[model samples]
Target: MNTKWWKEAVVYEIYPISFKDSNGDGIGDLRGIISKLDYLQNLGVDVIWMCPIYQSPGQDNGYDISDHYGIKPQFGTMHDFDELLKEAHARGLKIMMDLVLNHTSDQHPWFIESKSSKSSPKRDYYIWRDSKKGLSPNNWESYFGGSVWEPDEKTGQSYLHLYSKYQPDLNWQNEEMIHELYKMIRWWLKKGVDGFRFDAIAHIVKAKGLPDADNPKHLPVVQAYQFFSNLEHVHTLLRKLNEEVLMECDIMTVGETSGLGPEQALEYVGDERHELNMVFQFEHMTLDSPSTGTSRWESRSWTLLELKKIMSRWQTTLHNKGWNANYLGNHDQPRQVSRFGNDTEYRVESAKMLATFFLTLEGTPYIYQGEEIGMTNASFQQIGDYRDIETLNFFELAKTKQMPEDKTMAAIHAKSRDNARTPMQWDASEHAGFSDAEPWIKVNDNYKDINVEAAIQDPDSIYHYYRKLLALRKQHKVIVYGEYKLMLPLDPDLYVYTRTLAEECLLVILNFSHDTIEFEWPDQLAYEARELLIGNYEEVPEERKEGMLLRPYEARVYMF
Candidate 1:
């Protein structure tokens, strides 16, 4: 509960591939990021979370790193990256790179040497096992689909890949591999990086005595995930890394963990443990998963109660134990306004509501690029318009399974990576003003109405509301380090909470419904309500109000 710079920080995740392209090469680069540092600073962000820029074949969109010490040629030379880091720090913004230690590209030197011969010393750096009865080592499934193990034709063995085949999982059991990773981490820290956003950190360790996942039910993939998620030694390795390198520097460390709960999350980022500063949980992200798995993305069926319960559970649990990284959208997920808000009708109001819901919570907030402008998902006429590797693989898989064309398209529409990979909309010109040439991916059809230039000029725009929310967080101590108390827990339409520190208390009320709703203010702080910090759609009414009235998608922050 003590004060830490990162604990009170507002992080903005920038997918370098989609943020801005300066050279007009159809790809975003580091120089492009340097040109936009002032834009981020004016938005009131403290930390900039950048995706990987390391040398790679881009097999998994740069997640599969080929070199730890060098920058990818396409992104620019190390000199460009150094200048970018220096410029960001000059603007009082910390830069955190995505550290993908969980895996490496198959084209990496280590993997090439490991696969050269059976007796190669580097062979142990990666996981390899003989096929059991001429099949995979176990029934583990890859996140992209098919078996997790890929057969190595040269060695007559199979290597594990929790994701794509090009992304081979590293063997953490190897001491040399751990040391190599630590050396790379220290190298980046020495180069003046603020911290790292660890990718798939939970999967760095695996359950021992590995067995076939229990797939008696029809959920074969879900069962496989349970078998390998949050393995026993994951925390141990994380703590060791923290204690050795990360803790030595005043850097912010966050893990991208998917299957961890509030209780389990504490082990990685609690006050006593010198591990991660926080973690990103996916409970809220999976709210729309259909029971029958028939229509996951196209179905808009999540109730307000479900959304409130999901967020409240994490907020309450993290308040007393660890900390949370509050976010509604990221590079891997769809835009918030598109997924949660009424994109066609009440876009601006709902965008502000979602922003208020996250910023006022008792944790750091991460804003994805274009989120401040209320960006929606792009409309694709055909699947060929998509460039995401996952979408391509899924489409091929669906075809092999003999699923209907419409069914496959529905699945793609629901979970396509292209939803999050579209280029950032800067203006209303051609290509949404993202690039002079064609963008790497398609722009949203509503770009002309929901671009950054238009929002920055409008005081009531979602972008300005986010700026106000961030300013409030910086000016108020209670919001930074305070005790959170959930109010009206059982209310379906109203999501309310209070953050208190000493004599100062701040109340956050959010109406998640499209219709008006009323709530009786809690008596404890009702008499002390003073100023309105940030409100969506309308301001707080005058005093002597028997109960609070909320307009459609209204949200307000009150100081008492």
Candidate 2:
């Protein structure tokens, strides 16, 4: 396995808009992130992944970029960004910027010119097509809902927008556009930024002929990713990106790739492929999502066996070919503990169990903001509480389907993207100490009990557990370079795995249930444990005997 700086690093993702508010503006800025550097340094994370802070219209939050070279006024000035880079580097932390390349805000200069007229010089900068039989060029649907093509009144044509109408798809086929993008990337690298997290990378390449999605009527527009994701020329584009700007610097790159399986993932992230260091896939994220086409709001119960198979397959397949970016939640998904673990009865233990499972796996683990303190999903009562465009659009779609208001609201509360967008809880004061002024969005009500101030003071808090887990990853090389193997793969609620590198082997046992379970020690490698490196319980039985009983949500990492 490769032993690069990023390979051995633990990345912490910060949604800048909600991370902190230094000026009490109700919005998090670069200065706010700067104020929390020491806190992150002490947490022992090596890389800080900052979400988009570029100039945007705020339609889709920061994803709708109006200027790639300029910083958003809400996020502070370019001077603040420079200071942030310098300060983070001084603290031994690298920063990765979010790169939104698949589309640009409709207000961007290039798009504006393209929409001016068909004869405009920049008409090809974006994908533009004439109306087909008085309808959209194709039946392609927007990820947010409805048709992908939007009418351009001035040009008498339609523009492709796979996401929100405000975010127009860029034409990668335009060589001039690609050249300018590379130039922009080089400019950032020249400014000493570490790397990038490419957004919606898989959707950059559309299939030939702008094909319609299969059974389009039976699937939600979000699931219609089949029409746009993992197309033939994506690999070529990635290689070109790597050769043009990426290879010029020593930095890390992770792609937000959807609609990819284990086999296809290896092609993009293979060590010698020159594409990307790693790619984030959504198979695990959608495990609990109902199989229905129209609504992703409804949640369906998932079995432990199903979870194990999905996780283990990725672990084993990518062991030798490529690296993995292990994560359960991000700015685009709901809280990890609330969705996968018992957030009520065994919140701390289950959170610790999940950490043990992912942190110890053969991958670079990423921690979303507030995840260390066991932050949960926002308990929204009304649809008005949501600030995410995706959530609001889905609610509108639900109403159009004639779904009852109560039922639609229930689904919104359960699966809304706003669940992860709430302001970070820093303390027990008003607005969870995120801001004295009213926050742009509502804060989670449990912030008083789950704030960082409380977590840091409690020695056994989930925050401290996370600190220890990160420390272990840096202290031991096996956790980063070891081979992974799933043990007791068929267990309904018990998740057990082993990591081995040469003569050293570590066993990770996690009971992901609300009841105590008995675990029979494996006889294949009959040996006593050398040390109990970490566990959530007050006392873990030191006796290495057969049929050991594990407490509810118990997680233990044993070295032998």
Candidate 3:
């Protein structure tokens, strides 16, 4: 395996709309990020992966790009972006921009031209076809809801959008479109971006003839990912990108690889392949989601054994051939602490425990904004409180299906993307000190108890624990380059793993439940030879005589 800066570094993800708000505009911007550079540096993060800041219609919260070369006016001008880049680089931090190539906003000039008429010069820039017997081109479902194909009366054709109607899927088959995209990518690299997080890159190449799926959703439309994911030509286009734009500079690239297993992930980021530096796998994210449901909005229960199985599978499978990007949650998912940890009674302990799980694993761990301070999911009672297009569309769909309104709203409250978009909590002020004005989205009610201001003051806060974890990663090479071996693979209440490099070894043990659990030291491992590195407990146990007794949600890392 190649040893790269990205492999040993920790990344911080910033959802621009919720990170911070400058000028009281109620939306986060480049200047706001610049203002918090010191905070990020203090967290010991090496790179910042910011969500899309490109000019957009805001239909999908900046995912629907209308102009790739320009910055959104709400985020400030090009000058602001340049200054942010300079300031971040000065602090020895790299910036990774979100690159959305699978789709573009319907308002984009190319999409507008493509929809103008079938004879337009840009007609082939987007996927368009005549309806089949007054129906969509295929039985594909949009991620939000309804058919993936949106009808265009002017051209009498339907344009494909795997996500929202406002976001039309681009035609990767078109040589002209691919050339233009490559040019746009080069423009950003020349402007000094250190890396890119390719958005939905797996869906770029649909199967030949856009075949129908086996109808997993069981609705009128089916989940068509089997036809679009892991296409052979995607590797070809990515290699072309690596040669044309990525290899020219020492930049990192991580693709959003959805609906893929560990075996499939090797093809994209293997050391032998000149594709991406790493890939974000979604198997772990879907562990808590229902395996057979039309929507993931419903509440589902998951076990420690299940989580361990999936995570250890990836760690062991990709240890040599490829790299892994470890993250418990991101912008599209609910808050990590609320979802994976005990957010009620043992909130702080569980938060730290979850942190230990990701940081101690052999991968590049990403810390989402406010995750260090243990910020949690937003509390919204009614459906009207949400602004996400997917949430609103799903609510409407639930109503049409005659589902209980209360049940639908409850699921939305539990799993909506908006839960993660709530504005950052800087202090205990009215708007969590994010802005003097009301935020675009409601601040989480728990911000008063959980904010950056409070975390910094306390030396043992989650923020400081994360800082220690990052420092440990820097101080110990075994944590970054070591081979992983999962212990207690069938343990129902505890997750235990060891990372070993040469003579050095680090043991990470996490208790995932509210009750205390007793663990017997394995006979193969030496007991007294280990030294405690860090733990969630305020004080390390003085005695190391017998079997281990872990308190509720306690995490311990030992070096031997």
Candidate 4:
């Protein structure tokens, strides 16, 4: 295995809006993140990947970039950001900014100039086309719902936006625009930033001629990805990006790559490709998502087998070819505990089991904020309480289609982005100690029981479990650089895997169910446990002639 600092480091992704409110203005700012640096350092995370704090119109939760070089006033001033960078580096923690280069908010200067008129100098900076049969230029749909082409009446043309219409896609084919983007990247690097998380990087290059999908009836999540994501031209741009900007510094770069199989992913993150160090793939995250043609809001039951298939493929395929960023929940998805574990009963145990399940794997583990204390989905009652644009758009659409309100609420509860965007529960006090005033989004109702203050006092809480598990990972190179092999692939109730280096091997066994089950050890994996490195329970249960009795949500790591 290669020796890369980024490969060895564990990342903690912070969604800034919901992380901490320093001034009690109901918003998390750079200062709030600054205040939590010690907590994060003590938790043993090496890198902090914060979501976009760049100046925006507050559309799409800061993914819409109105100004590339400016920090959002709501987040804080440039001085605050400089202080944050200095303090984090002082604490030996690297900061990775979320760079949204795929598109810019309509209010952005470049986009505004591009929308001025067809003859404007910056008109070509964005994707624009004449009306097709007096309608949209193409039959594409926005990712957040509705049409991909929002008409620009001033130029008597239509512009492309893969996301919200307020955010227009940049034209990568334009050399001037790419040159400006490179300059902006170099400026940030010179400012002492450690890394970047490129958002929606795959969709930067759309198919030539603005092609239409084969089946327009399919959900935009499915149909549009085929026409717009992970194109060959994306590699061309990324290679240029790497050579012109990234190669000058030793910094981490992870792209948010969607619609990529293992084969396709290699083109972006392969060591020889010079595109990115790693990628955040959506394959495992979509296990509960129905077929491509169906909406993600329309959920279905998923199986352990399906998850294993996706995870195993990525682990093996990227083992030597590239790198992987392992995560279950992020700002865009539902809470991991609620989605994959029994949040109602076995929340803490299952959360720890899951942490062990991923952290012990061969890739770098990423912990989303509030995950350490086993935070759950914010099941807000009314639609008015939700703040995510994606959820609101879907709710509005559902109402128009006469979809039952209860059914719509059910989908929101299960899949809404707001479920993951709730305020971070710092204590059991009012507003979960996130703020002295009302939070922008509602705090999860279970915060009183699952807050960090309570968890820190309990030695066996998920927060401490993460600290212990991460300490073990840092001590053992096998956890980061070893070869991985899935054991008992067909088992529905248990997940077992081994990470092995030449002279060191660690076996991880996890019970993914709520019932007590017996797991028969494979002949090849049979060995007396030498050391119980870490486990959720008090001690390792004895094995019988058949196997060991696995308790509910039990997680055990052993070295032999």
Give TM-scores for every candidate, taking all chains together and pairing residue i with residue i: 0.96, 0.98, 0.98, 0.98
Clashes of 2: 0
> Which pairs, if any, clash in model 2?
none
Give the best candidate by lDDT: 3
Off by over 4 Å in 1: 217-222, 291-300, 538-544
The CA lDDT at 85 in model 4 is 97
Per-residue accuracy of model 1 over 121-210 as CA lDDT, tens digit each: 999998888888887888887887778999999899998899899999898899998999999999899999998999998888777756
Cα lDDT for residue 286, candidate 2: 82
Model 2 lDDT, residue 342, Cα: 88
Candidate numbers, best lDDT first, in rank order: 3, 4, 2, 1
Q: How accurate is candidate 2 locally (lDDT)?
A: 0.89
Expressed as tens digits, the lDDT of each residue in 272-380 for candidate 4 is 9999999998988778887753577988888888888899899899898899889989999999999999898899889999999889877778999999999998888
Please give, for residues 328-412, the per-residue lDDT of candidate 3 as tens digits: 9899998898899988899899999999999989889999988899988886986767899988988898989899988888788
Of 1 and 3, the candidate ahead on lDDT is 3
Candidate 4's C-alpha runs over 4 A off are: 216-222, 544-546
Q: Pick the candidate with the highest TM-score.
A: 3
- The 10 consecutive residues of candidate 1 with the worst lDDT sum are 291-300
- CA lDDT of every candidate: 0.85, 0.89, 0.90, 0.89
Clashing pairs in 4: none
Residue 25 miss distance in model 3 (angstroms): 1.3
Instruction: Give lDDT tens digits, candidate 2, residues 426-490.
Output: 99999998888999999999988999999999999999999999999888888998999999988
Clashes of each: 0, 0, 0, 0
Total clashes, candidate 3? 0
